[model samples]
Target chain A: MDMKINIAGVELDNPIIAASGTYGFGHEYNEFYDISEIGAISVKGLTKSPRAGNPPPRITETIGGILNSVGLQNPGVDAFIKEEIPFLRKHRCKIIANMAGNTFEDYCEMAEKLSAADVDMLEMNISCPNVKAGGAAFGTNPDTVLAITKAVRTYAKKPLIVKLSPNVADITETAKAAEAGGADALSLINTLTGMAIDINTRRPILANVVGGLSGPCVKPVALRMVYQVHQAVKLPIIGMGGISNGDDAVEFLLAGSTAISVGTANFTDPYACLKIRDGIKTYMEKHQIKTVRELTGGLIVESK
Target chain B: MSYQDYSCQICSQQEIAPNIIACCLENAHLAKNAKPGQFLHIQCGDPASMPLRRPISICDVNGDELTIIYEVKGRGTKALREQTGKVQVLGPLGNGFLVDNSLYKRPAVIGGGIGTYPLYLLTKQLTNASVYLGFRNQSVVTLEQEFCQVAEKVTITTDDGSYGVSGFAITQLEEDHKKEVFDIVYACGPKPMLRAVQAFAEKTGVPCQLSLEERMGCGIGACLTCNCETHEEGSAHYKHVCKNGPVFWSQEVVL
Candidate 1:
């Protein structure tokens, strides 16, 4: 039997979801394949005001992944709800609204406005680098993470998933901070910061100088973080980093992740999610596994 | 957007001298529909190295195949060279040169270095025309026979004086203006070359249309990343080099 994970009272049909910032508004990829196949779609990160993003050289290819510093570029929340929302509402999958706030009021303003809007869940992008404070202060510390989660929880009647940043002292500590502060669930491993240099020109490949790295190279770190965090907190965790195929998704599930998000691979192959979803089923059948839930937390650690 | 892998035969895989190479796409459907100035995004390598696809333009299309020219600058192009026999392309993408099919009496097609690419297609579409091409040296010149086939006059130029007209292509265009009333000028080349064309056109009072290039994301209207400010104002705002343009009236661009 397929296990259903409930966050705040809303039930998700399955744990697999397309992470925000990867699946842009959920319409373009739909043209190539069916959108209803995925359990949920997290629209691109939305903020209170529209952002132009960093100037030229937004993405650069790395050893095992690509480093990107898009700077959370998107239309304002109001415009997203007005323009991109209607097309998404017609789809069968659940819509996870990824919201980012620069300050406390930005968080409250987004939650207050989105609480009345149509969305299955409101994902707080707490891990984003703060322009004023520098770095992701909200996600790095236990105190601010708790405060931001509680503030959004006050007005946000919808399910809230605190998207955590991996650039932290302790993954479990931040997860617990979110759980204690009233987070319905959590998502882990936003891009790891990286930089690349161009030899011929003797300048950085990315104009901003540094970028967030995501791809197969970060999979182990993401998995280890997911496995450790899952053991610490009871909140349903959505794991993501470099989940390319179904086997990778299974490792994430076995590591105690309730769901998995496939990014970067979608850029190379647009039909990534569907392929991973099918790969999961084939792996389960081949291994004689009955249900996906049984595979969750199934990592058997033998004493070395 | 179904991607079918294509293998390049010997003739299509010319060294074009040494470091420079040109690959051909042997797909019947793509070749039939591909317009000059249109480009194809070729997947160079798997993840771990060169993850993104590199965009290369269609140099020429014959029968059931299209060709692309490029110099191996980095790992992606090096990987593209390895795919020598098995190159996979995603287009005929982005709007190619808008053929002046509306009919013109006397037109001049100007090209500079590799910018001579789309002009080959535009000249084919311009029934009665003249071709003026400029390059640093004779070694870099391309499409001499094709331009000769399409136009009555092929005014070739080299800065080193090793070729036909020993000067700039734009200079030749200015000199020829005294010879005849060239109805319109169609061109594509380096930024400085186009800037010179813009200046020359301004001086001679000749109406010219140009093709602009920019690093593109979606090649559609959605991203709004690849836009060139146009003379047009208000809500429609700027012209997208991928969609609304790639082709524009020379004076219409803010440049």
Candidate 2:
């Protein structure tokens, strides 16, 4: 079965892409398997300047997911181009530079810089809820999402994907706003804002107190948001939120995501993307599906 | 070095202490490749309840058998204790301890509580190594015999005078350092113990390697969750404990 799919104009070998923050520069996972086997890698969130991120105890486990307030720790965009881009260029898969900023200027500067670099696509990470500034603040509001997307769109030479925050009322509003702002495509939902507490210490587990939750637990919420956003916007969706296995990927496609990104699953299994790719193929064969694209929005909801 | 997810089977398991269990697995590749300070990212429980893998340090390796000693702390480890037969494991991950006996002779190996488990493998690989171990009390003291078999001398301390030397292990290490200066120091323990060891190593001007533990997400460099602060040329930067090291030089990290 054909597994290739396209996000915006960029073609992928398969529908599975490694989500940002989860897969750092694609160097670490390369040790487990050839990273080129996956369609694309959304490198860790990049900022204009190097961010040291939050203090220790930045991560904690919840019921079936994890809470992280990493606060976008990265080596800055310049370093990424000089140090990491070369390593990623050697690999065959497409590179999606996931850039985050505390301001619209930060996003535009990074977009202009990265678009001139070797990356295949630029993902505006306005949805990161861990930071104190411009991350989710710009993502949660429709006007701000449109404004940032429009600002970054002007500078980004490559296809731009606006990652959406899940901690908002009516995610479709932001989805429509991104489309309005000239986003080539949309990806959602970025981690849900949540917190965990220690009863004994009577303190929040994460040093940042609040963090974004991702894993199998958030799959349902992500799928619902993806389905809703797909209905609300004309742009293709890259569905993500706790997708672990093949069936989960299939669910997202049926929910109207053109392609899917694997996030927290990479933690549980290093070879998760490869396994998920194989799982998608297996699912396609079992169902006599020809192309993986046929599965997108294939859900047959009976009219009751 | 490349790492693979191996389907390993439990060879044998036994409870060495209250809430502490030592289990052995059959994985020839891991046993042969695993070095001191390297860890295994194990899928302990069902993903629905415990989604992330539990990172456990390598305790010992004998032929095709790899051993790990873990304390039942939370839901994940509790699920690990109940696991039987086949288990999926990704290892031997992160940079292992660099063993250069010619560079440094008379190594001082110090460990505290559950932190002492990973040091067992290091102690076994070293020559003329004096070990210092600290535990809560007698009931939790484990691998004492294991360390004794490998080390040139072993000193164990308990906080409440319930076992061996009644005091902190760092005190014993300091007291012993005066008599015969150790060429190199290696330590793994709780934060306070590690901090104290870091200070001692700095004050003595002896080269030291410390094995650290953090709440990790991916037991690889991919997830920036497990990070430790380090200073280089006066600038502090974050290093992933899973990648840059579970082990680092004494002067490398901030704490």
Candidate 3:
């Protein structure tokens, strides 16, 4: 079994990573677990300028999960590159910078700056509904997905991992478009657009009428999409959605993810990422698998 | 970068009073550092009821553990109450009270409704203090005898005259001040009550510090969800209740 696999041209110690927004720039979870425990970290979605973020009621929890419309809130690209980048570099992990843009230009500007900054990869966010240009408009249409991916891919010197939104009619067409646009790798599925209603008040639970849903409820949907997209495109795939424990992480990898990102779980337990990290090695050792890279999409298909 | 949330296990859960529960946590370190008037961010469920965590104030600290007492208010609080065993809590966070006993000969502790939870610990830290707590009626009055153990005088007020004193808590705290001259006033509870205490402290020109309340996210200061405007400015020109204070000098806050 080979331990080394390539994401674009860069090498990661493992295929497990703490996802964006959930990890909060990796510096935070470092307090509970060692930074070296995970393969990489996708920092929170950053824009061209600092964002104080949306007004209150940005987050609410539902019966099996939580919904959020944080509006891609961050201290902007400059602060992230200046203040946040140095801290990320101190840790031994592949730093995947997640970039969000209100317009194509904001995407280009952030990608260009982060490309020059010290980072191993760039994760382009096309699924965020918090911004006008984000959400379904950029994700649903294949041509728009291609155009935006092409635009950001030009400025990104590192591996450009275009995150695909699952709020579309067909996931394959969109994944193919990202491949056509030169995405080095792909990630799915970004939070599905969802809303919860307060029956007594007859009002939406979120301050924003709608929000993105992530957690255990969406795992089957995400796994099915990852499997579908894996067949549609040749790009290395990073899968995420309601992943909590090592068993869940293995399920995503076996479903055809080259790597997996742990979201929602970080809030359930701050040390959840480290738990998955250790759990993966234990799983591999028990199965007599010498390397995690061997587990990527290694599911034995049973006859229907 | 200094903040993170964890799934805190319930070490001990005690029913301190009717509709009020005192929860002890497995966090040895948190119980070690919490001071009077401090708070903790609770994740009501494994995935959290809201995208963020709910903030609760510390009621007592014993050894490597701390206690938070609360009445079920909404979904977040309701989820916390239903947690069968251990629940996740983020704190002992926010600045606790200023208990510098050297500056004041006598201290007065005031709490209103569920806000009295923090005052239970605040009065214990003062050299000499009186406990004045108020609730809606017989259903809300909690921790009276426990407060009596720490305070020189324990005054309980209920709106229906079902408890010790009739009328509001402020009326009880200000009934008279001639004993030792309460030089410092400390308080917690709903904002209206804290405001009333602030008014009396200002009228007497007595040094006062009030325990404030705000819903929080990351209790260590990173997430700005719990920010409140004050006379003091930090990196962002606002003080975070989860970090700089859930406890602030009465004068330092805008209201």
Candidate 4:
């Protein structure tokens, strides 16, 4: 019955947070439904300065997934803090500022700026592959992960959630590195790098040639990584990747994630988070579970 | 505008030209509210099989029936071509065309190939508008008769000398402008054609609005996909084509 979740001292009425880049400042979705109905919203990826992003043809569809090369096109952090934060502050749910940068200084500057701002959490987006640099690079290596997480920790006054990259060799290593570097919590898995070709045109579908793949296709990989990282670290995990419904959210919760974020599913249905939240409630009721926390790490597997 | 996805009955489906199909659906709200240049994101295949919805421009809206014209581009549209009966769609979405009658009393409408589809709605709304359409050749020329019925004057052209006019549509528009000057120009088509119109608008000191086509993730503003750079004064800003516009002021965007 109780769907509340506490991630790094920040409380969510429910465990559904709209993933960054997928949910833009909550203005668009707010037009569809009362966005305050959802648990929280992670605004679009932000940087120190405005970014123009990639060229046209930034998105290409795949089997049960999509590849996006949006390149973090945003109106800069100052714009977000000036123009967007006040609007976001009007909502009842927590606001997680998803920050991306082309360099370490950019991340630190954004971390410091957002820390003193009105946001509830800082979600460091180190796994964006659509950009040329400082995106997936910081998330792929344990050293960079530790270094960036450590560096960002100094400036981030709010809870720091290091979003892990699935493109890495072992996700647990990076998750452990973030934990070692003082991450309050973690979220995963940012889209997996993939490409699709236009057979008719004999060219890549996306202008960027390669993009991060997300949606139902990557859910299994996301669940596996969340489970592995949960065992490797003691931090609460925000699991995501193709989470379309409450059943999918339940899968992530049982895989040791305290909460889940809806990404690609938001494209298919604007009220995906609300549906997912209701689905989890229905799932809990049917299973006679009292609280969603009971579903965390509830997976029963036999040792081979 | 409401953003919830709706399931509408497929009233009919007809192939208007080679590789192009016109689908008519019965959705009262969309038909009543959908404006020129607004699009619908239709669920192409089974929800489980295809997670991404295909964004299609509304070609015509009559009472409770909304028609969309699309060319088979990929697996999504290929699947859409086979859809029948009831289909789920999320839209009447994005910022539609702003047809400020005060901005331009007499307007010129230009369309290239599939780009001409959305202009049908725009031309219908304009009381006095000139329509110029360009295609590959006579064989692929579509909606010529429809434009002729709505437009004050209609000019059709082809890349090769096989149809109404011997040259590009922009050339025809330029030639016609000398005979009768247009207060404004509205266009949709290939990128180069749009770029040409943008230049023409600047050179002639006439206002122009262009509808852009970009690959999109969410036809709504959620996903930052479908980004197009816009220039205001000397600064450049990015806008989501799916949200901010499929249609923008001529000088506002960089083609």
Candidate 5:
């Protein structure tokens, strides 16, 4: 019934970590329950300068999921260190600073700055589709992924996790590029690029026109990609994309993810992570699994 | 600061107006903590199809029963209408309307269409308040008797001259303002109506609080989906409609 997971030397109490953007700075969900019960909290995506984000009608619902083009709206890294870090420091769970940038320099600068600050890990967000530049741009190209990951790796003092884009030709190519660039670990798949249009006005629902899709609808796709990337690379993967329940978390672990991150589920239920953790424990007890590590890459495939 | 998820039992459901249904839920905790402008994020139907929760404003609260009036506008509300037995709700969310009877005696409350539902609670809390409600026509007009019982004066208007005063409600509010100035103006409605109220509040130099709406995700500060532009000077040019406010000073927001 042990739920502990160690990612690149950083130990998590459980495998259920709150994903970036969906959980914000861990302030809102804390009102529902104590945030310390979860494994880790990945704060909202931050940048070198403050981003105003996209215009209104930023989100719309699709079948079993949602499309959002928030465009990395944050108060910049300096403000997060001064205003948010102190609050997160008081908590018992580990903190992962999710950082995005418009250029390699922006990535390196933030890496150097946040590495000196009070955060447990640094997650490079190179797959945000909402931003116009340097987000999905760097993640889709293997050479750019290697270059930026290597550049940020030089400055990041803590374990660096490169979050990959699902909107790519081959996810394993980029996963291999991140591995070659010295990433401590990998996390995927950052939302797929999609769009929704209103029929009456024949206008796009989101002001940005295109957005990233997340929720239960994308679970199957995310699982397939995680399985592919796991076979291609050696780095431990933090699989995320439409994980709602404990069974979903187990699917990710069996697909070869070292840990799992809950995103859209938090919106559906405030106590999603805690419920998912309990669900995992219940599954473990029923199956008589000794440790969570045994569940990783434990898929039973038919032998040829 | 305190909020929890409650599995509320559906005590009764009534169709107050065309396509508008009023449902009373039994939850003592939510009823006691709910304020005037706060809202509840409710999960409708099954989670497989309708994954997101709909944010419904508090219409009325009596003892341990909380009432929410919502129109069947989209798939979410359609799913909500079919709900029976019980529903999961997370509520009394966001900063509610600031009510200080000592500070403002004569208050003017204005609302249009479905927006008038949330104001019922506010009107009940105020002592010397005049209420103005507007709708498309007679078939959509609701809560007339409810407001009449609470407000010192009630003015109902319809755009097509189907019932009550024939014209926009703001026109009557402007005419009423000339005779006796109000200390404060509170409003919630369609954008056009809210825009007129905002201009009116600004021109008269009277303090105003407006309840705004947007397509929301988390119904909390966590998801930055529900955001509105503000006139405040800072790096953050926008405030979340779910957190910073579903209610804000008329002058503070851009509308």
Candidate 6:
């Protein structure tokens, strides 16, 4: 099966990419299997400077997913380029540098610095829901989303994919705002804001009080947002939320995603990307689809 | 390393205590690679019902089979008890305990409640160590016979004096250490007990290693959710309990 997918001119061997914050630089998962077998690895969330992340109890399990408030813990952009990139370069997969910034300047600086680095693409994350300051704030407002996207676009030499947050009133408005800002492509939804509590202790389960919920629970909402954004914007979409298998990936593609990212599922099974890729291949071959492009926007809506 | 799931058939399952059960699985790779302080992430229940895998410690390892003892804590664990035929496990994860026989000839091992499960393998590796165990009361006390067989001397303590020595296990350990002047101390338990052990180890100038526990996601380093506070250079830093360690030197953690 032809599993190849192109997002804003960047060609991927397969359509299964490991989402940001879930797959660490690919070094850890590489211990289990050859990570290059997947389409690409969205490395851990990066920032202008190194972050220690949140306090203990950063994660809590829910019915069908997990809530995390890791607060973008990573060894700044420079360290990632120096220490993490060399390791990733050894692999044959595409490298999508997922970056987080506290301010506009921070985002611009990181984008400018990484433009000269050996990375395939830049995933601008203005929608991380865990941090208190700049993460979700810029993503929630249309003005800031456009401003940040346009500002980062000035220096981001590689293909820039703007990641959208799900904790918004209308996702299409934010999607259109990113399109207006000159984003090469888009990906969503970056964890819905949620909370879990410990009844015995009578306190919030996560130290941050609330966290971003991911896994199978958020798939329906993510699919709806992707379908809406595909209708609202012309930019190609890299859809992700609670995508667990090839069936879930196909749903995103049918809903109008150029490619799909496997997020929280990587935690449950490190080989989820490989399995999803194979699952897509099995589905396509069984359905007699010639190419993955044929599956994109394949959803048939019934008219009354 | 990459975490992969292995399906191992159940060798045996027995209830060691009121709510605790010891399950043995037959898997050669896990039996060979798993160490004293490391743990396994077991996928509990059917795929449709369970989202997260429960992390359980290696209670004992014999030949090609390993034992995991768990208490019924929540729905995740309660679901684990119903396993039959084969079970999927991802493991031997996190840095295991560092056991240097040359460093300490007379070692003291302390464990409280479920925390004792991880220390079992550590005790078996030592030549002549002293094992101190603490439980809520008589009904919850477990692995007494197992520890007795491994350690040169064993001390069991209960909070309400239902069995063994009364009072906290640390008190007994402190009282015994004065006469023995042990070279090394190892501990795993509740925060308060670990804190007390840390204080004693620091004051006595004895090196100690502790197996810390926390709520985790992706028993690998990627998720950075199982964080623990550690002090370095007059400031506090965070390390992932899943990767950086489930085991750390006594003074390395802030508790």
- How many residue pairs clash in each candidate at the backbone level? 0, 0, 6, 1, 0, 2
What order do candidates take by TM-score, descending?
5, 6, 2, 4, 1, 3
- Which stretches of candidate 3 lie above 4 Å from their native place? A1-5, A133-136, A197-203, B1-12, B24-28, B40-55, B72-91, B103-108, B164-187, B191-245, B248-255
After superposition on all CA atoms, how large is the RMSD of candidate 3?
Answer: 4.0
What's the true lDDT of residue B38 in model 5?
Answer: 94
Clashing pairs in 6: A31-B2, A32-B2
Interface RMSD of each: 4.6, 2.0, 4.6, 2.2, 1.3, 2.6
Candidate 1 lands at a TM-score of: 0.86
lDDT (Cα, tens digit) per residue for candidate 4, span B1-255: 357789999999899998999999999988998999999999887766688888899999999999999999788989889988898888888777778777778899999999999999999988888999999998889998898888898889999979898889999888878878899999999999999999999999888889997888778776777878777421146777887898898888888
Off by over 4 Å in 2: B233-236
* lDDT digits (tens) for residues A1-304 of candidate 2: 7888988889999988899999989888888888889999999998898888888888989888999999888888999999999999898899999998988899999999999999999999988888855378899999999898988999999999999999988999999999999999999989998999999999998988999999999999999999999889989999999988999999999999999999998888888898888998889889999999999988888998
Residue lDDT tens for model 6, B141-189: 9989988998999999999999999999999989988899889999988
On TM-score, the leading prediction is 5
In candidate 6, position A171 carries an lDDT of 94
- lDDT string, candidate 1, B1-255, tens digits: 333323334246566745678776687777887787777667676544555566677777789867777777677878777764555455666766555646557788888877787677667767878889998888877778878998878999998998777878888888887898787887888888888888877877888888777655444333343556665444233556766667777887766
CA displacement after TM-score superposition, residue B125 of candidate 3 (Å): 0.8
TM-score of chain A of each: 0.95, 0.98, 0.95, 0.98, 0.99, 0.98
> Model 3 chain A — which ten-residue stretch has the worst lDDT?
A51-60
Each model's TM-score?
Answer: 0.86, 0.97, 0.85, 0.95, 0.99, 0.98
- Computed on C-alphas against the true complex, the DockQ of each candidate is 0.30, 0.64, 0.28, 0.61, 0.71, 0.62
Candidate lDDT scores, in order, read: 0.75, 0.90, 0.77, 0.89, 0.92, 0.88
Check candidate 2 and list the clashing pairs: none
TM-score, candidate number 2: 0.97
Docking outcome class, model 6: medium
lDDT of 6 by residue, A1-304 (tens): 7878888888889888899998888877897889888888898998888888888889888888889998888888889999988989888899999988889899899999899999999999988888854368899999989999999999999999999999999999989999999899998989999999899999999999999999898999999999999999999899998898889999999999989999888878778888898889889999999799888888999998
Instruction: Provide the RMSD of all predictions against the true structure, rounded to 1 decimal.
Output: 3.7, 1.5, 4.0, 2.0, 1.0, 1.4
